[model samples]
Target: MAGGFTTMKTLLYRLFVLAILLSPVYTSDHSAMCAEAATPQTAAQKQKAAAQAKKKKEADKKRAQKKKEQVKKQKAQQKAAAEKQEARAKQQEKAAKAQAQKQAQKQEEEEELKQAWLRQQAELNSSTPKKEVVSLINIGAKFGYAGIMDKMTNNYANISRPNELDNDYAYHSLKGGPGAGLSLTYELQYGAFRFETGFDFTYLNSTSAYEFSLMRRLEQPYGGNYFYITDDLRETRNAGYVGLPIMFGAQFSRYYFMAGAKVGYGLFGNYKQRGRYDIVVKDDALRDPYGLGIHDVPTLAKDQRKLSLQQPSVSLCAEVGIDLDEWLQAQPDKKNKKRTKPGERLPFGREHLHYKLGIFAEYGILNTNKPTGALPLSFNADDPYPQQTNSMLSIADTRVNNLFVGVKFAIQFEIPGKVARPIPAPASAAEISVFDKESMTSLTTAIVQVKNTGNNRTIMKPKTLSKGVIRQRAAVGEYVAMAKAKNYYPESVAFTVDSPGIVVPVKIYMQRRPVFQVKVTDKETGAALAAQVQITKRNDKETAYSMQTDSVNGLSEVMLQDSLQYALHIEQIGYEAVDTLISDIGDKMHISLTPIKKGEIFVMKNLFFATNKTRILSSSEEALEALFGYLERNPEIRIKIMGHTDNVGKDEANQRLSEGRANAVREDLIKRGIDETRIEAEGYGETLPVDTNDTEEGRQNNRRVEIEIL
Candidate 1:
């Protein structure tokens, strides 16, 4: 790690040195521009930088937060940057604790927004052969002439054969009807014996280049320094090829002659070595060959069989031509034994180049085999369906008869083309290595839309996005025209969606609702009992959705439907008050408190007090205790407490007795924790209603203080 740090420092130093070496003016200028842009709110860039640095020190342990894109929407009524860097610096930290919570219960409006960024990329590869662009330039195009001769059109390259060529030797011999296939010549220094392909008007679709063999067309030389002769004439029986022909010219001084021959496989294309022939054919020509029907016809197979129109078969053809006036002659009969003029004649073999045009006769032998009997021309018992397939005609114009009888009209051209070379295979060590791709750890997210819920539409920039932001966009515009759009959502509705099971604090607009309210009344004789009431709040966002209830007229005036169903009850003496779920509600609501009228009230006998003393015995603890809750229930009722006394003392003593007794009773009620305002003590002085006190029991009853409900 230390080495890495040192290397990083060195790299930084090198970069700084390189930066200095470049135009410092421009670099400094760009730095100043960035500084100014970053300090838009400051008078000077330095001041802003200092402020930022100071703030950074204060925010030492602050963590960064990731920002999320938020979009919100609503029904019927809907509503829905430069600080960008600052926000990014604090995004992750902010989102971690980010929340839209409302503190007050007065409003029931909710809005949320979240935003996130996403990125994606793709690539593809393969392990197959690469595409190739072929051209002959790699080597060179095979040079050759490909065309058919209708009849050699008065050209020196014309041929004339009477026996086999129908009379019109011009067309019948050259173009050769279905006989002329193609004339393709190739000289390849390398490569294989490819198939000879050409464009034939008779069959033009065979356009592929096939491999050809390196079969040399040279013949053996007999004497010391011998010239090349046709292979068959040199090798005799050793060479069996008798169908395909390869023609080339040999020149000596002013005389030149064209010479070539045909070669082909044995019958049924049987192997010359060790393969068995699958099928066989009759040897009507004394050429016993293994193969199928009419296949063993080499003794009569035509050289121009590929042409199909005119057959140039079974013979050696030689023609002579001179630059101006040359001559062609036959070989000595002692050595070869063949001629066009017959009987050791001197043919047009060689001469001087003095004539403007030279014409010479040509000869072709069909190499036919006769049966030593009259050659059958038709089917018979000895030779049923006899078919004479070979024809040997001597001395005639044939395949390579170049008897120049007129001026030659031709042009020489250089053909630029391509040749194919076998591509070398790659080595095993050159193979490519592949590895598994890494998975994405950062989350991918995007905002579908943002909606504005305010009276006026507001812009939603990337940086100013809130976690509770809501917005919806529309494309309702004509071409090149403004669109019809407005802010969405009304403020009066109160609907919200929160994360399941958890409610975030939020502010929302809502209509007011009736909570709980009640009026007290006496049950026994239908009288009003003004009772005290108390109300309070409970939830996550706020303490309550409505007002709190407390000691009052047993009725609460507030705006909230939740509080209506809250616990509500009233208490009173001699009454089993009802506790109800405050459910029924309309435009307004009212509830009546009924007092208990069924159960009887407990009565306690009173006790006499001594003169002038206001203290009561402990026995008074039991006296009027049942009525303690009664006074507590009716807190608004004010009543007077009266006292009576027996006639056993002076008038002043009696008055004191009344006052003392009344005071004693008042003290008793006050001691019972009743509101002093509901109790008024009065000394009646033996004037108030009293039970008969003449007897001792009546006197005891008459000694009781009278408590009344005002």
Candidate 2:
């Protein structure tokens, strides 16, 4: 074994050496194998890793691209939304600006109207008068006829027997004579009413004639005889009286009438008489010789008497006359050569001496005759000369009244009374200035007036301002200062004069009226058209101006307030009416009107109705008037009223509503004096639409009432 071991060792050594050498080869091979195996696996892993990395990179790129696309889309949406928001904000700002402008214009108009009214009132207060009472005295003289009226009755009888006859007679005649009177009167007059009281003196004269006769058969120693005697007398009477008269009357213009009572007392009366008479008698016993008798007889002395009047008289007196001063003043006074002040009276002027001439009458309403038991005629036959007496008034059994009628002349003097003193002007004056409102420039030619509001009297007359200013002296009171200039609105300012010497400064700003030329033309042809243009205040409907445009120029010029709103209406024959508001006066107005003809359609823009109903509102008056006027101007034209509605309700309901609206419009035209046959009504419910019904604006356009010429 040892040997074998040695041999094997040696062999092993060699084998070892060989194994070593092969080991290197095996190591190399194994290493190569491991390297090959590792190479393939590493290569496969590298390939798998590379393929995975590529796939992941591709997925990351795809995700990143998708995210970019999403962001882009989001950014696009944001841009669109921002643009929409910006557009909406711009629209709102534009609307707000328009509304503000409209409101400002309306406010300016109202202020101007108020200023005009104040100036008008100030002018009316400066033109009125004053009233007072007066006192006067009058002295007058009168001449007239005085008469005594006596009622007389006479009884006479005649008896005839075989041998005796007797007769008696008495007669008297009285006549009136001239009279004169003097009077002094005091008078008080207030406006048309007057009172007068006075004392007067009168003298009267009268004349009368009296006759008496008596014949009696006397039985003497001789056979039957007849005796007769007669007497005649004439008399004159004078009377004087004192009287007091009280009168109340009214004077109308230059004429006056007074009626009252006059009480009088008779002071004295006297009478005188002169004349002749005749008598005759016949005797039967002396028939053989002759029928003889006394033929003529007269009183031994002329009858005359004087006595005091015993009765007082009360009489109703009335007088009517014209103021002679009024007529005298109208006559030329050539004799008045004295220079007189503004209100001074001339030395013999009729102003202080009022002369009146009037007719007056007085009647005594009491009995003046005294009755005594004395025969009218008396005679004594025994004496050679028979005595006879006559009393005519004593025999009368009635009352006697005295009457006087006369023309009176009177002169009146007005007694000066306490004169009303005028209110003194203030020591200090106020400056009133007139200026243009827009330019703040002074107006030199502006008329300035200052009025005292307490008395409504003008403190200063309307006078042209000097250098746009006027100094006014006013009493302590409220006052108004008014200023006006040509082509400018009048203005008034109220101020208070608190003290007598306060110097107040008053400023009045006048606005210049805007003058505009209005032109009307045909819409289609752009040609001038003659039309009637009417401008009215928008608030009160008061017509401010009305005129017809010139036929050639179709132009009318008018003054308008820049601050006021006005309604302008233009109309012409065979043309559609134009109604518009004039809110701005920056330029001349150009109104274009469409011609009315067959197949022409016009929307009634201003027509308004009650909510959801066909009843017309009062605000629709202007529209209705325009339509009526158009129809009236063209009598031969026929029209159709068509109504439409938005598509918001049932078709049937909408149809009914549209029909009702159309009929309402038609009926309104008929009521406004249009012929019923000239208008026809129809409805198209949502079928014929002017605009889309989806939006609110579109729906509003679709719902309309229009007139169509037929």
- Each candidate's root-mean-square deviation in Å? 41.8, 32.9
Off by over 4 Å in 2: 1-133, 154-174, 209-233, 282-304, 329-350, 376-381, 384-391, 396-398, 419-710
lDDT of each: 0.34, 0.71
lDDT for predicted candidate 1 compared with the true structure = 0.34
- Among these predictions, the greatest lDDT belongs to 2
User: Which numbered prediction scores highest in TM-score against the true structure?
Assistant: 2
Clashing residue pairs in candidate 2 (N, C-alpha, C atoms within 3 angstroms): 109-563, 234-273, 234-274, 235-272, 235-273
Question: Tens digits of per-residue lDDT for model 1 on 1-710?
Answer: 99999999999999998877587797888899889887766666778888998898667534221111122222212331335556675885666545322322112211110100000001112233233222111111111212121111122221122112222221222211111122233321111111111111111111111111011111222111111111111000111122444434543545555455433222211101111111122333435433322212123233421221123323343334453322322122333212111223232221100221222221224422111222101122322222432111111332221111112211111122121111111111111111111221211111212223432343223221133222322222111101111111112212232222122222222122333355555555455544433322222222232222233433445444432334444444444445544445322334455553322322134344554465666655434553565676666666666777666557687777778777767777788798777777877665653567578877666565665556
lDDT (10s digit) by residue, model 2, range 1-710? 88898987787677776776576667788788878778877888999999999999999999999999999999999999999999999999999899898768644532332233333334334463233467788999999888876655544444343211123445556678898999898998876788899899989886666555544555543444344434546556677889898888888777888888888887876655455434334545565423344433333343334443546777778888888864543321335433121223334444455678888888778766665534434546533223654444555354567888989888887664442111112244678988899999999989988888888998899999876677777656799998889989889999997755456899988988878789988788777766778899999999998777775777888777667788898866457788888866645888988897798787886688886788989987766776786677568899989999999989988898899999998898887789999899999988899999989999999889988889
TM-scores for the candidates: 0.18, 0.35
